[model samples]
Target: MAPQPKHKNIVQILTPVVLFSFFSSSLAEIFFEERFEDGWQSRWVSSDWKRNEGKAGSFKHTAVKWPGDPDDKGDDCFRHFAISAKIPEFSNKNRTLVLQYSIRLEQDIECGGDYIKLLSGFVNQKKFGGDTPYSLMLGPDICGSQTKKLHVILSYQGQNYPIKKDLQCETDKLTHFYTFILRPDATYSVLIDGRERDSGSMYTDWEILPSCKIKAVDAKKPADWDDREYIEDPNEVKPEGYDSIQREILDPKAKELDNWDEEEDGIWRPPKVPNPAYKGPWKRKKIKNPNYKGKWKIPWIDNPEFEDDPDLYVLKPIKYVGIEIWQVKGGSIYDNILLCDDPAYAKQVVDEVFANREPEKEAFEEAEKVRKAKEEEDAQRAREEGEKRRRERDYDRRHRDRDCYRDRYKRHRRGYSDDDYHVS
Candidate 1:
């Protein structure tokens, strides 16, 4: 046979890979994406639910304060904000769902929630608030030191269940990306700044369903059961005079002062210090109990109430994505929200769009240094001015006092009455 061309062989080998890539890209679908560019207000609905109470915050479309793409504007929340955008209804019944977004806590958020909610079904976009029903909520909730965690809450059967895992969130005054992926197999993954922070089965991580096995309530410890592993040694007894040892004793080196009088100073006593010879209350030595039983555990039985859910990972038809937050001191900028069915796409967005975080952080640190330097300089100038004023006041007061004294002396030399030379 004639020799086969090398290029033909290479093309034959690469055909399957290229086809697979094409199919994979076609399968990935994006349900919603918000970049907060111009004309974004037409797509988003700002709720007036708290506006009458003056609690509704306004969102300004602006770019990051530090170094970043000037055209990359985000929704800047200055207070309590409730805004949402309607997305095409989609069901993630048998596919992976990815929710990703970027947040910039420019004000170093003291206490507030920076989470976004995915609402299912019909929602009055004009009245969307905290009470609005949502299928999923994902983002960081910061409240001082105690609450600085990224929350991942999934709603199932009218009840919302929060993730049991404690995931620490980024608290720096810079932009960060938060990504969450929920697979059809009931497994979920949480990522922060493009790094996987946590991943596990949704069945185990969330309390959406009853446990498959539970401790038997009917099982009880028998009357003869002995769970203690150790007992006091029978041969050990309290030593003689042990109870008489005092916890505190007079210092031997302390001496009464020579000037101290017995009647005036009361009875002179040396300060009491911790006694060296004294041991604390006696404790009998422990010995391994011969008849000791191991820890008693109630037998686990199949939970009758437990029911396996084949669709435990399925959320309702998500139709709207919202940003409803309550911030005390707000300067959080939310941007680049994406809802898709492919984690790979979400990761690519992070690597491309949100990759300027390192530069943003560098710019923030440099700005902070400049601000601190300016504050210190202003403080030093204020101090110098204050000292100058104090010196001027002191000089005037001293001169005035000397003049008064000289006038009194002159009056006295001239034989004026003592009352005539009254000091002012």
Candidate 2:
């Protein structure tokens, strides 16, 4: 027997760790990814459904005004367009499904949708529009002041169900990453900019299935049940003069005008004013009812119509990723789309690729500052020029009037007829 070298022992210890890392990486699968680089036009098909109507807008392969990436490239959707790309068919059965993407609303989108859809079954990529059926739809939708939320809709049993909870989304002009993860345990999580914004069980957040318990149809409150907790005090009596109190009274400070004539005008009467001492209609003071009972409710029983679904989390096989939106004012740059099973991988992509958010924001702020300053400068110049023009016009009009007056005086001294001096 001989002692092993130190390097050989280190190698033996590191070998298993290396092998585990390799195998762990293999577990994560990337079904589709779109960086929106050159050659993106070849992969995507634009719909012609609204082309004849001239409602379909085209997508530009460009970059945000401020470049977060060194390569400054993304899918610029400047108008309403429906575009889709075919992805490898895959089902999220007994596995995690992750949808991640980055969006930059450079145009300060007032009303538009930035959602992406995961379509299942056969799809006509060239004609995919709002009517196309999808298995999942996720992203932010901003419309005026009321709607500014990240949508997470799932299709189950041929019906689409949006998340019950209202999840606020990023509405700034900077770039943001939206991530959605659905696991095999019927649990889903929503992440914005690589941080968890919301997470819950699908059963609780979506009305995909009938409730496990429902109010019993036969259960009803008894006719004699006193559900009211408070009632008017029977023993309390109203003040004697409460009913006689008038809401309006003649003003004590009002005085009859000295010129007021009772013969010409109707007899002068004091104006009625609101009486400060008079309270509104009387209300009886409430007291705890002696016979009061808690609120009566129909008792819940096991719902006979409810049926459990073990595979409720499983979605149909998705084969395409589509984007169909109508933008009123479009300058949204979409980039770094990814669909995979591993959340860690998605986060890593965000960390590595979309990490320049701070820089992008700084660039945008700098540009905005410059733009505002320029506008202010232009406004000030316009005001100064307008004032100068106004002064020149006034000076010219005054001088012209003075010259005409002098001419008229001279004509009078010359004894010319008034009609002959026309003040030219």
Candidate 3:
């Protein structure tokens, strides 16, 4: 029997189906299998197993339950296992060396101990077996140490931060999810049950790939003492540098002046009135009073020769002082707009304030004058130097012109002598 050609739509559908099936099978081979009784399978391998530096034995044989329970009855146990493969998904220029494993904890125990540990963060195959890497335990057991705590650790540039804490660990009968996203910057973060922890900034800095800023936990801490820890992503922090800001100038308008009040003890107090009559423009006028038109003596003016003494006639110094103090305390808007209502009053206060500090103002003014004089001197020196250069250039050009004329005259004399010899 002859075979029939497949339909175009059927080929298209089958192509994707076959591709998806192949992809799923390949991923299944790479990822650890989830078996209930067996715990989690390992998807990685260590090269230093032969040297006895790592957990020695077969991949599955070395996978033992925590607290050395062979029955696997503990809350934490390995579920699956595999030899490590070069994970292209998690590998790049910013290489993050990580060992991931699946762990199952039965219930919230007094102390949680099931943690996917990373012994070393380097791919130096020989270093793992050497004395250097063996001497240091690369990671810490965060969840196993604290009750009801699920901890995820992220290490970047030799520094470590716990990505997750189970102070508020949620308990459910179903599977509890804990996954980490490792970036090329050697920084990582964890998500539990699809929700991120409050300390998510660690992941942000790692993902953002920012330069690390190492700050002392406490600014005033001693070199030997441990600083009180604070929540901050070192990578996201501003680097130490300098910045400039524009300065603000005070406003030109403000307010002053009000009627004198004696009832209030702390209020304005008018100066004592002089014994002599207060004189004004009206007092000097020749207009006669209604009662005594013919007589020059006015009732309001007891003494015609009265010359007002400001010390006795003016308002008390305390009254003016009170107004200035009020304006200063009234804030920018009140001080600039309300208190400066009368230009005359504002100018008077300013003059009085500056009059008392005339020496300091004069000294500043003298310094500014000196600075101006120095600048003028520098400009004059520059002009003189430029003029000198110009004069030297002009003199050289004149000398060159004279030399050219002398050379031409010598050449003409030689030519005339040669012509005469030829003629002879």
Candidate 4:
């Protein structure tokens, strides 16, 4: 859809809206917001990851409380987590870079990475995992069926790039709300849960803005470049005996097999008939190539690695912002982080933290239907208490085998019973 301009007076929204008080941006300030409340684990930092090694989980914390709790339940185990956080100096040279947060997968996210990262050096934030090194990484990655876009990488100076926009994220499970901005005149936007789907120009949506016109390193094309627009008709010729016709023909109303006895039925032919002005393999009519010089452009030049970047959407002062991911079925629930240069204060922190994400996703779907009906009623009362202790151990082993078969028939009717039922 490539057309979302709307940055005019930065923002306005009124009719009793009051979001960002006249759409913020008086040189927009607030460079950090993180509402993980409760001292955010002393400013967020976890990475000693355990559970089955290689890319494991552990970053915990949640007071966005209630809902069958494992951080507001859904996809049970925080599926192989990875957390990060630093926050402080979010520079944009002369302003413009407005990340915004508030996610919420909570299940139905098969094959992971619920995006979120916006870091910048000072590195080792408790040895941040997932191959540390970040500058800009926006969320929602999904897998299976070759991933569903909306990623947005962008490191610039030290490389990174990504985000040529295929951006189509939000796959179910509620509570979205992403919103990047960038803009120091290099342009970019992208919002969800707050509108706008896409917007361009990090010099045409990013490859870190280099091509201000390339393609002509002597793009070369002249070996008499006629690009063949069309030409076989030098007066169309091909009519004499067009390949002696023979492409499966014999079925000319054949009815000569009746009581045929011409020399023992070997001479009553009448089948091979397909010469109806047979025009099988003869072509000759193309025409229009007056030395067609129209498909050979090698022009455009001037990109000595381009130069007019108007601060290619500046960066490189960002202090920190992380949430590095890789969840496979972990209940996601990031909340109102608001690093800013204010696209109206990240739309007024997404209307005050996503206005209770639809009543916290309807109380996490009624606590996932009361946690799947109390795990199917505690697994049907542990399968009816192990089927009542296996029917009381098969009714006390059938009444103790009928009292040891009536005491071996009264010790063989007092015929000097052997070892008295052997009870040592």
- Give stretches of model 4 more than 4 Å off: 1-91, 94-98, 105-115, 119-129, 135-323, 326-329, 333-340, 347-349, 356-358, 361-365, 383-387, 392-396, 403-407, 410-424
Q: Each model's TM-score, in the order given?
A: 0.71, 0.70, 0.25, 0.31
lDDT of 3 by residue, 263-285 (tens): 65454433433322222222222
Q: Over the stretch 342-406, how does candidate 1's per-residue lDDT look in tens digits?
A: 88877777777545656667788888999899999999999999999999999999999999999
Candidate 1 ranges beyond 4 A from true positions: 1-25, 217-297, 396-424
TM-score of 3: 0.25
Q: Candidate 4 residues 179-298, lDDT tens each? A: 888777777788987788988887767766667887776578879889889988888777666777676577778878678998876787677766676766778889899998888877
Better model by TM-score: candidate 1 vs candidate 3: 1
Write candidate 2's Cα lDDT for 1-424 as tens digits. 4432222100000000011122444668989977754477788888886776655666544434666544575444334567889988999999999999877777666687877899999998878987888999998888888899889999998999999999998888777889999999999899998999999998889999988889887887899999889999888888999978999999999999999999997799999999987989888899998998899888999889889899999999999998767666645666677899999888887776545667767788888999899999999999999999999999999999999999999987899667886866
lDDT for position 255 in model 3: 24
- Clash pairs of candidate 2? 57-80
After superposition, which runs of candidate 2 have C-alpha atoms over 4 Å from their true positions? 1-24, 216-299, 396-424
Assess each prediction's global lDDT (C-alpha) against the native: 0.79, 0.79, 0.30, 0.67
Candidate 2: 10-residue stretch with minimal lDDT: 9-18
lDDT of 4 at 39: 56
Model 3 ranges with Cα > 4 A deviation: 1-102, 118-146, 157-159, 163-168, 171-173, 182-189, 197-199, 203-424
